[model samples]
Target: MTKDHVNYVYDPVVLKGRNTEHPVHPLILSRSSPREMSGEDIPDRELMALFDAARWAPSYRNAQPWRFLYAKRSTVHWQKFLDIVKPANQAWCHTASALVVVVAHKWTVDRETGKPKEIPTASFDTGAACMALALEGSGRDLVVHCMFGMDFEKAYKVFGIDRDRDGVQCMIAVGKRPALTVRDREPRVSQRNPIESFAFEGGFVKVYHK
Candidate 1:
């Protein structure tokens, strides 16, 4: 574990200018997506631990539809994965230790009917799994950033995905963050909107927007 992971709770870099309306876990508050990485390859053991955490995410009828396809830096598959990313993203993603494509099984086979059945909750369940993966990486002081700037169609072709049953959700860049000084940390920590702005008491309510 890095120094940030060990002292996450007390790290001035994480706690600086951040506060929640209600009390929450320190780990939740410490999580942030950093673009700058060390380009150092993560050990398979540590990397798989993130996916293991993702396995426990809740899903509709326990479908567990999420799947992660990844390529580590300096590997044969690295160029292929990188090619799928957009130029703007590639600028920063080149330093990522690993690139992962999170896919969801949009259909599941029904035992009773012995036929493919649509899974409406596939995307929602997969998102939860992605959150678990990101949180786990954050807990380990790793940069785990998700992006939508990849060619989904190209990914399907490159990965040989079944378009009829599977859908690409998003891409994830995982890596070790470069050591940071306090002066350059603020931009890395994003602020959240207050609960009242997003969470309504009972149902949806009209809210003003900029």
Candidate 2:
């Protein structure tokens, strides 16, 4: 593992400042996925800013195929969106300031062939865009949590998503994090697998071990 990331995953005290030994930005290390959302609505401009950040993520063939469906906490659509989430997820997520559904175009017409072809990187690129949105929200001190704990069939029906062309990629809950209540579970940061476990040098010829 890179020393900085190792410190980040194992030693909180070593990650005290932006200029800590970590090689990346402090925002990355500090961001957390918290379930205790404050239920306050985000300002419209602030919310759009997150989307604006997502707009810049790179994609294959320059096909930025991601689409976002968003609903603020108090809107009629918000309840409808919340109802699609599993009750376990909704128990914590209903307090989020906004619910964002990430979708991707599964197929795009080939410009040259004039025929539809699967965009192999559509889901991959959408995930990168989601990270961009997450980083932007974290920079603004907002907590963002992405999930798979929703009813995809219900989501497709409610959002009018044509599954043949579009994929319901994932869901995100965004809000200013709230203080944990006694009844609420304790908030804790999770660890990551060491970089050594995943990163390879020349090729996938060999894997690193601690």
Candidate 3:
């Protein structure tokens, strides 16, 4: 990680625009992905700690299927990993300390039939794992940005992941942020919709609720 990264204080501007209807953990409000990074290497132990958090994410049938493939900066695998990202994302990702490819197994043994069955919640469970990793990174005050603008198919080939058996979830960029100045105008934390818009009492709510 960058020098003083652990000691650096975040600018209040990052927290200015967010508000919530119901109270949540302060960390939830503070976590926002920004593209700016310090281009410094993260310690191996710190990175592993974040993955440890992901390992605990809940999965259906206890079928913990999430797999993370990563390459750290200055490593032989770094260029190969960076090359798979689309040109647009590569612009900012060049400064990232680590790049992670999230993958999940597509099948699990059916308990009843003892046969191969598609894991219905593979994507959902994998996403939960990613969120846990992201939250852990956030709590550590690290920049952990997830991106979908990469070549998903190429990831399977580059990382030797079986496309038929495993699904590529997304790519994540992890690094330390450069010092923020008063002039730095990074985007503020995003606002989320009210719960009533997505949550319902009994049945699905078809219309958009303000």
Candidate 4:
């Protein structure tokens, strides 16, 4: 584990009622995506700290090829961010505190070898960064909802991102949710699928069943 992972702490509330048979980090097992977010703005330093965690995510050969561009809610860039989202997403995401564009490059030079390394799986590396960011946001009592229902091509054009060279993975909405109302109470808590459903023991031939 990286130093950041080792130092990460989570709220006790997140651990409540989680299965003891197969222990997993509460942050990973309990994190949820809020459909509605608070309009309140997040401090710039806090946002930067989350990005810092993403920056340190492990990558193939340390290619470190993820880039993020964000627009703070209530700013001039907010409309640009909103315009890219699908109408369905706009209904909920407009209330997000911030919107970010995630980009990934397909290749990078190996620092030690001074040769270009083909990153056929750049999206996987970028996903790792997104996971780190999500965990960091959760640690701060914030929610991060990733959305792919957006005009990614248009966004790439607007942002001057070369789609041929860089891939626009998805947009992330980061914020705290508004206080839960009576109707919203039930959906506030979420659960994840059992690990046995996805995890294998030694190989694909050996399926672990709970």
Give the number of the best model, judged by lDDT. 1
Encode model 3's per-residue lDDT on 1-210: one tens digit a residue.
343334423335555667778776766666778888889999997899789889899998988889899999889999998998999999999999999988998899989999998888999999999989988887787889999989988888777888889999899999987887222665555688778888899999786545
- Model 1 clash count equals 0
For model 4, how does the per-residue alpha-carbon lDDT over 85-170 read when each residue is reduced to its tens digit?
A: 99999998988889999999888887779987778779999999999999888777787899998998799889998877799999
All candidates' lDDT scores?
0.86, 0.79, 0.84, 0.80
* Candidate 1 accuracy as TM-score: 0.89
Query: 92-202 in candidate 1: lDDT tens per residue?
Result: 999999999999998887768888888899999999999999888888878889999999999999999998889999999999878763326454566888888889988
Q: What value does the lDDT take at residue 201 in candidate 4?
A: 85
Model 3, residue 47: C-alpha shift (Å)? 0.4
Clashes of each: 0, 0, 1, 0
Better of 1 and 2 by lDDT: 1
Which stretches in model 1 have alpha-carbon errors above 4 Å? Answer: 1-11, 111-114, 181-188
Q: TM-scores for all candidates?
A: 0.89, 0.82, 0.87, 0.83
Model 4 ranges off by over 4 Å:
1-20, 181-184, 206-210
Name the lDDT value of residue 72 in candidate 3: 98
In model 1, which residue pairs have backbone atoms overlapping below 3 Å?
none
